[model samples]
Target: MKQLLLVFTILFSPSFSAQKTETFKIKKYQIAILGDSLKESSGLNFFNGKLYTFNDSGNSAELFQISLDSAKIQKKLNTKLRNEDWESLTNDGENFYIGDFGNNLGSRKDLKIYKIPFRDSLVLDSTKTISFYYPEQKDFTPKNLNNDFDGEAMIFLNGKIHIFTKEWKSKETTHYIINPENFENQAAEKIETFKTDFVVTDASYFEDKLYLIGYTKLAKVYLIVFKKSENDTFFRETPKKYYLGSAFSLSQIEGIAVNKDGIYISGEEFHSPLGIKKGQFFFIPFSDFD
Candidate 1:
């Protein structure tokens, strides 16, 4: 595991100026502390009415079925794939897509997404890889966390995988698209851009509302919701940004999955020279924040 990189992100992350957003205390919504198995849980999503999650790079290429009531792992399903740097999770109804494109260093040349057909709660034998690269990223230098090519959020819609980048320097997110059907290494088409002022780690599109979750360099976590996207572009409308306390208080908020009942969020365990915080699972109802 990138322990040095983890420490670097926690201690050396650059700060950003604040923007006006509704503040909400998130400790009350935290239900459980995710244990060691999911201490590095990076993303969350609902597939076939079941919630699922997995750790990031250097972990097993397995998905854990999370129980909503207990926030515990109900089962683990192996995908038999290489978990180079799994960062995003989403489903296209019948298949689950995992984005193995965590380019925090902005030095990766081969970014890919795994597509596995899932049915009856089991993965089919046929698994495919959707390779992609950023055409705009001409330089292959290691910028650590200062680059804009790092992506940890994606949503599958309209026969496309839309990626939202975790812009470390600009404090913004750029929208890019990749076709899953293309077996060749395709260039992710940059479609839109939004100055979120916070790093977007995971995105969930529920109903007409698109939810983005991530934190800042100074550990301030945020949740932004864009509603009623008419042209498939979520940035078209004004989004409701909510301040969910600091990462020290609410863990390292990294994952979000929205449903009719409420919003499901998970944060990976964070540790540094300052202090250590355990990973946690949170459930916030729409009425509480909406």
Candidate 2:
């Protein structure tokens, strides 16, 4: 009986069994061009299998819809919301939220966001706008290398709006939660923070995880993954470092969005001596991460 039991244990044990050991491998994706000369392509979101993106700075503030498979622009919707330093954008099932909160000088106080209904024929007059402001925090300039505190990335999750800062010179990220229902005088509660090796420009949530992409001073763009904990906080779960490579020929990569299809990245042209084009979009297929 002892000999029979030992044979059974050996056959059923995971270590001794013939079952294959599954290993997770990082996959490379082919970057497809959505558009060129985007004039600071800042935000990206997907709706019903199509891709939509907007410019961060410029007049008119056009929202562009593109075909993901063909990488072609299908339609351009001119939003009523003026682009006063438009930074980042996201969607919440019914409406699209555009953040006009690009406070670079660290002086402006009246930051705002625009909410537009998702439609096939959205006109400039049909858009709605909402404004928000952060409470005063003693008005101090960023003295250290990591003090730039303006953002272009805002997402609507669980009926609340969550904002992430675009650190111009910081390796750490601050998360704030806001009440979407009460836009005016919405004091952002600093919920949590995370540190990164690269400057985080933009982020998006997909598959129950948050993915942040940013560029380093060395001109390398990286992707960092974070998984949410039970306490409603997010913690970095990916390995130490993972490089997504450069965004086009430019280095200042900003926007990132993930869906069931794959990962999408955008860039604001880094300071170049050769005078490179301003903004562009690139994408990697979802299967690459699998």
Candidate 3:
């Protein structure tokens, strides 16, 4: 009887693992090698047909514009504002928003987004500040990067700024919204909550589609695409998720931008018990997924 049970376990274990495992292949191409200043490039966006990115915590408040042909920094936009953990970037045709709310520990009270009026050039002096807080969070204690209130990805949608939280404790994402016109320190409206099981690093919206990029605790990278749903709400429809790759090959992916050409991704240099990698820039053609 014991031998029979062991044989059953051996025969069924592989099937069980296969049943639980879901993965999608992505065709990736190397774009460039990011510089030291952008070793922690945590946010990415495309403005005026140019790709831009910036470093996250412990870095300067500067935005680097990269040339697609050469895949090198062509210009750097300097801001007088402090970079207190800027984590995401978004734009609304005429203006740009920089999210300064990387509360990994969930103890932050000064969460804000800087809005810069833009047309022909990037302006830093004429920027406005939009502040917000979660209405559901009552605790101000630091939890050491394992909290639900932590957020690093956001995008502009339907006249409002939608923020996606990088949940560490629950592995779920909470959707929130803030009015761009209202800059007062008000409570963000909770839209909905869903299980992502990965930390969202950056988000982008284009052509009525939502694109999000993130990584797992084990360094597995993923991309989630949400098509337009009823009334234009992202949660009303099921999302299509695709596995990008592993950190051993891609490092700590932290940024994503999708356009007519393809999907662009960047990662910060990573050094862990598993492996070490440098800051990288990569692209995956839409044909591979579409």
Regions of candidate 1 where Cα sits further than 4 Å from its true position: 1-14
* Predicted model with the maximum TM-score: 1
Candidate with the larger TM-score of 2 and 3:
3
Candidate 3's residue-wise lDDT over 1-290, tens digit each?
00011223323432111112247644247667777777888878998788888888778888888876545888878877899989999888889899999887789999999999876576766899999999999998999656899888999877889999988777777889899988799799998876776778889888989887886665567788878666556877778777777766776788888788888888888765444577788877778656
Q: What is the C-alpha lDDT of each candidate?
A: 0.87, 0.63, 0.78
* Global CA lDDT computed for model 3: 0.78
Residue 233 in model 3: shift from native, Å? 1.4
Position 44, candidate 1: lDDT: 94
Best by lDDT: 1
User: What TM-score number comes out for model 3?
Assistant: 0.89
Cα lDDT of model 1 by residue, 83-186, tens digit? 99999999999899999999889899989999999885556568898999999888889998789899999999889999999987788999998999999999
Report the candidate with higher lDDT, 1 versus 3. 1
Off by over 4 Å in 2: 1-30, 33-37, 123-126, 140-146, 236-241, 247-251, 274-280
Model 3 spans > 4 angstroms off: 1-22, 25-28
Candidates 1 and 2 compared: the better one by lDDT is: 1
